[model samples]
Target: MEAFTTHTGRAVPLRRSNVDTDQIIPAHWLKKVTRDGFEDGLFEAWRKDEEFILNRPERQGATVLVAGPDFGTGSSREHAVWALQNYGFKTVISSRFADIFRGNSLKNGLLTVVLPQRTVDALWELTEADPTVEITVDLVARKVTAPGVEADFELDENARWRLLEGLDDISITLRHEEDIAAYEAKRPSFKPRTLTV
Candidate 1:
């Protein structure tokens, strides 16, 4: 997973609430084992409508998504976070998010920002009024800001540290590699071995 510090870019305003994992990336897209190429399936169903906010040309290359409440509300699929990241969204801002979805996003380095409904609505309005307007999310400061809008967001301390340091679960464990090696070196010879001959 890539490290996330601060990101500033155009935000796509997606006003629909209760967006589920399946809507973010349909089940068919899940067949692939690799993380790449999921961007084609991001919002697959909605993209067919042509009028969907994501399908709009101006919304292309947007790195931030300002979505409605209850975003990522269904399923525990990590693919939802993969699709969002592959689609170039570094952060998602909403009033509320499913607990599982938020966890998945954080693990994959996709920052999920939760703010009050009023603040979320203001961000949507700002992005809708001018699609080119830039929104900045500062993880270190725990704040999201745009023209005439500034809101504080919450993030777990450990998750914040992981993102700031670009450390995934495995990377975190590897940080103590020297200690793990030393412990293994002192293990009894009769102890069950972890490796095959």
Candidate 2:
């Protein structure tokens, strides 16, 4: 996970609501064992329509997603987060997010910003009108900023710290590597070891 302090980029506005995980990345795409190739599968169904927001030439290369309410509100698949990240989205802005989806996104270093419905609407409008508009998500300041818009958001301090430090679950565990090693050294030879020498 890369440390996230602040990110400023153009956004892709997904106007539809209730965008579930399957729509983000269909179940068929989950067969892959690695994360990199999922980008091709991100919104695979939606990409079929040239009229889809994501298919618009102006929205190409957007790094942020300003989506409607109830975004990521279905199955608890981490692959959804992987698809977003793989598709070059660094942050996702919505009025609401499913608990599991939000958790998965944060763990994978994808910033999920929850804002009021009106605020999210404004962002969608702004991005839609001008695809070049740059929206900045500042984790350090806990706010989202764009031209004529600034909204404060709330995230627990621990989650904020983890993002700032680029510490995923594995990274957090590795921080106590020395302590773990010491404990393992003291274990009886007959005791079963979870990690091989």
In model 1, where is the ten-residue run with the lowest total lDDT? 163-172
lDDT of 2 by residue, 1-197 (tens): 87889999999988889999999999999888887789989999989999998899998899999998889988988999999998899999999998999998999899999999999889988887888999999999999999989999999999999999988688678989999999988998898769998
Pick the lDDT winner.
2
lDDT of 1 by residue, 129-188 (tens): 899999999999999989999888888899999988888798679989999999999999
Kindly report which residue pairs in candidate 1 clash with one another.
none
* Cα RMSDs, all models: 4.0, 4.0
Model 1, residue 18: C-alpha shift (Å): 0.6
TM-score on alpha carbons, each prediction: 0.86, 0.87
Cand. 1 TM to true fold: 0.86
For each candidate in the order shown, give its overall lDDT on alpha carbons.
0.91, 0.92
Model 2 off-target regions past 4 Å?
Answer: 171-197
Candidate 1 local lDDT, residue 146: 95
